[model samples]
Target: MSTTTGLWLFRRLWKPAEGTPVKAVVVFLHGYGEYIDRYDAAASVFARSGIVFWGFDFEGHGRSDGERGFVTEAGFDAFTDDAEQALRLAARQFPGLPIFVMGHSLGGLVAVRLGARLAKAAEAVDAEAGAPLFGRIKGFLLSAPAIEVDPAVAQPHLVFIARVLGSCMPRIRLGGIPAGDLSNNATVNDHYSRDSMNNTRPFAARFASGVLAATEAVPGIAADFTWPLLGMQDEGDKTTVPGACERFVHTCGSPDAAFKLLRGRKHELFMADGYEDLITGTIMPWIEERCETAEPEAGGAAAAEAGLARDGMSGDRDDEAEPTDVDAVKTTTSEEPVLGAAV
Candidate 1:
């Protein structure tokens, strides 16, 4: 886990018991040409609930180091400083517990910019208990959060000429995201084409302008997300943009934000096919009710059983106008969303 661009960053863990007393502490983030050991059975289902998973491998994905599926321009703006250096190394390797951040696709836009810079660095101070746990962060689940870019497959004129002509030859190459568009679940597209540290190719026009400036800065920081949020997507997710992650979890400013739905059109729902019902009925009851923050409503009852949009339920492919997701073997980037793979 060194860097200064000399690379190295590869860490991965999944301890469930070593001297028990675990109910929280996760920082998983795999997505966009994956790695972190393919979430080894979703970090053994949060180490069978004792929970203490981990992550890394984004300096150039998989076994870290750099080049495969590319990155640069500050290695794609240090994906939220390597997930806030794995959330301060999971609060110094799980000291006072209470941390949950389960990002998928583009690590759910860098865990919503490290949960809005640890919710404004836990509101300027008084993080209590020897201070600076950055307000202990007890939530954020998101799975398909590449926040906006499914214009029926990358069509804002191919995301405006792939970040305006790939920022003038910024490492060129281009094309990606078609391991069967990541999941119509043919055995998770044949185990993402027999793994091999899955990069699946073509990317690096400055990693497509760092995935279009880290997913176009997630809906302008969804009102500066105060933390505690749930996301889950795939209303025919052709990579990202499940109604731009249901309008950025209903424009989060978190009163415990929420939005759920991961129907058949999968985007690696931890290997699809009942994926243990998103882990024994929705992510261990939202990590055992946030192990301390007295959890209850990330829009409760599994987001009213995924009917979302509060209730007015809008579907018809969530049209607030459309046209994105692409790559005919090479069309710049944007989750390599091919036009036909409906999810």
Candidate 2:
């Protein structure tokens, strides 16, 4: 456990098997209303592969200290600040190793923003003293980022009202996310519904509004992404919009980015049945390929261009139009309680 930014964050570090030299470190950011322990299975996969894995509960969720589903001030900024702290912790704990940041759902938004921020910070430092500040970060992996929430849950009228109320009574709690919308896997859904540490409380008005604003800011940030990125989203997901992922992949500035649209998966991809092997077979190889190489491929730009051409998006950099009102969705919170759920 570590305390920072006015909260006590519970952290778990998974090391490689005995005698294995850690080749890289992965800092994981879990989804909203969820905790670190839920990712133990995923973390173990990295551990077995000679990688170090670390994850923490967000300040207001899981074992972390804060008002449930609420950010005291700037919502996205606060979350990113905590994420940066986690990255710094990883750097300090495993110096001289490449670090990869992975985020799922709400955590995905944080990871994407953090990658851009780190790239920008490195650029600034290089310009001044020809040195990089966060040169260790190799890439980012985003799973079903909460760029746009389910439209059914975030009605336009409700969003408008929430924004107004956020400016006034920012602390007022509103309804939370619907559990049924999380995944189609019965076991995973059952576990999520029963987890006590899983926060199903209504979100504070300010927090909800802040998330909406952050989601809207993704396109603007995509133009600054400089690291390798891999984004995966479930086509059948009802928790987040798949089109948002498509837009981000097309507009992202990285020449070494790829997007995978899973046909029948759900919001919580890691929790879905038979996903453990899927992650190991697909996601692990992607991360390993990058980790084994010090620099991005020289043909990354050409490859990205080829991808754009194949998608009929050549020279279409300006296609990042904001989604319509019906598509403007933001995640919500609920107040259901279950025993043995808190991490």
TM-scores for candidates 1 onward, in order: 0.32, 0.81
- lDDT of all predictions, in order shown? 0.65, 0.70
Off by over 4 Å in 1: 1-100, 112-120, 128-136, 139-167, 170-173, 181-184, 187-204, 208-267, 292-343
**Prediction 2 global C-alpha lDDT:** 0.70
Backbone clashes in candidate 2 total 12
lDDT digits (tens) for residues 255-341 of candidate 2 = 666666665557777766546554665577777777785532111111111111222111101111111111111111243221112
List ranges where model 2 is wrong by over 4 Å.
Answer: 1-4, 127-133, 150-156, 293-343
Over the full model, what C-alpha lDDT does candidate 1 score relative to the true structure?
0.65
Candidate 2 residue 167 C-alpha distance from true site, Å: 2.1
| Tens-digit lDDT string for candidate 1 (1-343) | 6666567777766666454446676788888777766666656666656676777667777666777766666746677787887778768866666778888888888888888877776777664742547556678888887866665666777777777656777777768787776665565577677766778878877777677766777767777786767677767777676667667766767766555566665677666655655665657776676575533211111111111122221101111211122211111124442122332
